[model samples]
Target: MTDKVLALVTGASRGIGRAVAERLARTGHKVIGTATSESGAAAIREALQAIDPANDGIVLNIADAAQTAEALKAFLDQHGTPEVVVNNAGITRDNLFLRMSDEEWEAVINTNLSGVFRVCKAMVKPMLKQKSGAIVNVSSIIGTTGNAGQANYAAAKAGLEGFTRSLAQEVASRNITVNCVAPGFIKTDMTDVLPEAQKEAILATVPCKRLGQAEEIAAAVAFLASSDAKYITGQTIHVNGGMNMG
Candidate 1:
């Protein structure tokens, strides 16, 4: 077996996912980043060129069970199971609970919650066989704070945390750890689209008086996947710039 650790990061076209993929690669892993579209996958591949020429991206819409299975199987057949897997692919459909359409709720839940389910299901067997792996899921503060106009997102993220805990218990005996990283407001394309006034209002609420960086979140994920975190699982590390603290 190759001594080089391998990591797979979903939704790596941009934002926090991209940062995680690059960070893992820089930390000595051969990273395979996924994007929903061919163009996005290409962009990921190009972005990682500076770190490792062998680093590449794949087109994977985690919402599609067949595609997720096929892609994962092909990777396993070729490169074996990754030592680290980050479930970072998620979407948000904002609307009041009263006005939330069935399509909107389903879309967010299916992609954010069920997609991770599919990925985990596919990875579990290999991880069990390998007897060592880390699965770090990206959750959100909205799940805990309960943001308005984001019922679907909150529900999905909360469900993800629950899922993380249960899976951690089931696989801990095999030395596989499952954990979550819940980020507060981060400056991604999703947050960048907010109006200036709205952005300022949010910053005002954060004790740090600024939005979190993608790299900061990536750092949290890297730690959780490292040996330092081998004894820690079934928990969440909130990286929200003191937006919401215990």
Candidate 2:
């Protein structure tokens, strides 16, 4: 792949997305990392620049369909369609299924599941014409194991896997592979906010004896998005450090 090939990483302001953008940039791809706020966009830009001093950053809210389309179209118009797209923009509206509000459920689905669809739909045209591309959706261990308070999040992530598998088959002939990475207990901003006791309890279950880093998850995404994984598609690679073996 050329160093100029553009890669778009959603939720790139921090955590796993930021690490993934840095990794891809280090590999020579001109990465575009998206954030939701002005501060977030600034942060992403600064973070990416810290890695390569020339990578791009933009603001995007995946849950908003119109903005998602417009932002992607703008990016493609200015830089070119990203050959690699990472669907890492996700949110959690954690609550028991019984008490979860409809809005909470909708917001989670819109951002995590439908957001991936919106992005894939916008980018597939150029990828199909080019006849080469890769998409890696970020899933979660909760999606597979069903965490009690993360009904909305788990459902959305689980749906992303189904979408990846089906879309992989649809686009494989075009040389565009779709896959997913299910990360567990990553020490991200989200998990950092977890209660100390909860964090400790969760850490005990991880055989690695510690939480995985965002960089660890980024490594998996980089490998899967590279030509090294050309023959791999429609697969979900777990990066939970032996938390849930499948």
Candidate 3:
């Protein structure tokens, strides 16, 4: 790899995305993180500047096709193609299958699944031209285990995993790898709001007896996006603290 390879991470305003962006920047990547709003983008830029002055962030709503295209075009024009892409922008609208509204399902699917498709589509062509790139998608344990009130979230994540495997096969010969990091019960803004009793009940199911940290997931993402993982592709690395082991 070059001394300063270009890397893109979506939803980098906070949580695991921020951690991944920081880790990549520390490892010498010129990171370009993304968020949906100006404030979020500013946060990403500020966080990344602590590591490298050249690293910055952009505004991108991956679920919006036109917005995604415009953002990617501007970014590509300014920074060339990213050597590593992390699809971490996602949303969840948790509701039981019986009560899940069309809007809820579409929101989750469009953002989590289709948004990833759009981001990968924007990056893969450039990656194919470069003939060397790595794409790490952020997935969820609920995708495999199936949560009761997260039908929409689970479906989108499961779809993402399938998409990753298929795209990995398509690009492996081009020297690009596609993989996923599925995290379970990670400590984040979402989990922080859970009631203490609920949190304790959740921890009881995990052999580790604790929640995973954002940095922990970031470590897995870093590994998958590095040259050290060159031999790995079309795989999902679970970072759930033994909550759902194979």
Candidate 4:
């Protein structure tokens, strides 16, 4: 196993997660990315192998606590404790709060908000012992600015930011920094698959004409993961192109 710092990207099968995994591998980090399924794992392996065959990949459903614990243990048993952890796994169930089913809210909260709690809890001991670590959560613009039909997703993400702040303080003395990155509309398979008219409507709300590239977010992750960002913690770096800046 490469001794360079290991970075884990959850939901790394595609989109921002995939891009971050590949970029980290290229930057010489031992990238161990997670997929929710076998096919997704294979895609991650192929993508990483193309960059560096030594790269690592695994399948994980963060919402499953037992599986999550086992996967993290196996990942470390093979690669090692992560020096950088990106909580990028997420899902969206858009509906008016009044109409949103309990399952929808529970699923989103469990995976996006509660899921991070699970994964981070598992990593805390390892990171604390290491005396250093970095966490970057993938939040959403809707988290800060409530959306019409994404109450569940927005609540989960907003909670994630608060979680980041609380966790950052808890680990600050250990030399670990925790932060979040809220991406605006990013062009990816996830977004590309959206209806064209829907895409146009989103663009109208964004001040910039173009959507963000996955690389842009990856770059932000890389920066925060590096020593250069040692002074920055408990902060949310929004990559939205002038959309809802606070």
Candidate 5:
């Protein structure tokens, strides 16, 4: 067995997920990142392997419950239980509530909220037997503040936070910590395409007067997953640039 801590990070092909995987690997964790496709997984593998040959990647679609369960079981059988699990896979189907199709709401809720439930259910037993672990679910500031055209996304993220708290209570006795990291407007592909005027408008609301980097969110996740945060559980650490300080 490797001396390094084992960590599983989902949706690690790009953006916040990619940064989280890299940060954990650089911090001495043996990371196994997941992407939805073979090509994306290959990219994650290539990137992480450069940091540590023990690090690897696999294809996992959290939207599929059976596949998630089966894949996680096989992964645990092969790599043992991970000390850390980061649920970062999420999709956005932005539409006004009046215009939003059932598909839009279901897709976001299924992937963002229920998908985390599936992953947690699969891993919680192993983590209980191990008796120590950290789970960081990536939420969004919009979940709290709400946003136009993001009703489904907001509802899913809000539900995720509630789920985090409930699960944390259930597992705290086992020394398993479940927490959330709610990021405000971060600089990613999603934000990069915004009109320059819109981008400026967003920055104006941020006290930092700038967009956050993916690495910044990664740092918070790294801390929550570290031994230093062993006593912390059922908490939501907001990583916005003073955008929403509620």
Candidate 6:
């Protein structure tokens, strides 16, 4: 049997999720990262395998309740309960509140908010039985700052933070810590496509005058998932380069 801590990271295909998965693997955890598509899963598997052969990847659509339940059950039965779970899968349907279609709002809410609920539901019982675990959900600065053209995204992330707090209270006695890492303007593909003027406008607002790196965000998550943070729970660690200091 592997001696490494077992960790599950959702949305490991790219960006923050990929960084978090790789960070956990390099830091001595046997990570199983998830992606919604087969190709994305394979990519994650390859990247994680390079770090440690015990690390793996799988296709898991957290938005689908049946699939999430079945796949998570199989993973638990086969690999035993994971010591850490990172809910990093999320989507954004950017549009002005008045212009947003019902589908756009529902899709973001279902995948971002409901999806997390499903994942936590599947893992919390196992963690309770084991009496120890860490759950770190990735949130966003938009949730707190209320960005324009991102109402759905903001609501989902805000809801996620609230959920983290409540769940942490419920499971604290069982030794499971739940927390959130709220990132601001991160240097990801999503931000890379912005025009130079837009990028400059964004950078001007951050006191650090730089876009946060995925690795930096991963570091915060890593800390929260580690035993070093055993006493910290139900807290949202803002990693936003000094934006939204509230």
Candidate 5 TM-score versus the reference: 0.99
Please count the clashing residue pairs in each candidate, in the order shown: 0, 0, 0, 0, 0, 0
Cα lDDT tens digits, model 1, 1-246, are 446798989999999999999999899888989999999999999988778887889999998989999998887787788899999999888999999999999999999999999999988999999999999999999888999999999999999999999999999999999999999999998888999999999999999999999999999999998988999999999999998898
After superposition on all CA atoms, what RMSD does each candidate show versus the true structure? Answer: 1.0, 1.5, 1.3, 1.1, 0.7, 0.7
lDDT (tens digit, per residue) of candidate 4 on 100-138: 999999999999999999889988889999999999898
TM-score of each: 0.98, 0.96, 0.98, 0.97, 0.99, 0.99
* lDDT for each residue of candidate 3 in 1-246, tens digit (9 for 90 to 100): 246989999999999999999999998799999999999999999999988899999999998999999999899999998899999999988788999899999999999999999998888998999999999999999999999999999999999999999999999999999999999999998899999999999999999999999999999999999999999999999999898888
Candidate 4 has which clashing residue pairs, if any?
A: none
Give the range of the ten consecutive residues with the poorest summed lDDT in model 1: 1-10
Candidate 3 has which clashing residue pairs, if any?
none
lDDT of 2 by residue, 210-245 (tens): 999999999999998999999999999999999999
Give the worst 10-residue stretch by lDDT in candidate 2: 1-10
- In candidate 6 the C-alpha lDDT for residue 169 amounts to 99
- 1-246 per-residue lDDT for model 6 (tens digits): 899999999999899999999999999899999999999999999999999988889999988889999989988998899999999999888999999999999999999999999999999998999999999999999889889999999999999999999999999999999999999999999999999999999999999999999999999999999999999999999999898887
Which candidate number would show the highest lDDT if scored against the true structure? 5
Worst 10 residues of 5 by lDDT: 65-74
Could you tell me the lDDT of residue 33 within candidate 5? 98
Model 5 agreement with the true structure over 191-233: per-residue lDDT tens digits: 9999999999999999999999999999999999999999999
| Prediction 3 TM-score vs. true | 0.98
Lowest lDDT 10-residue stretch of candidate 4: 1-10
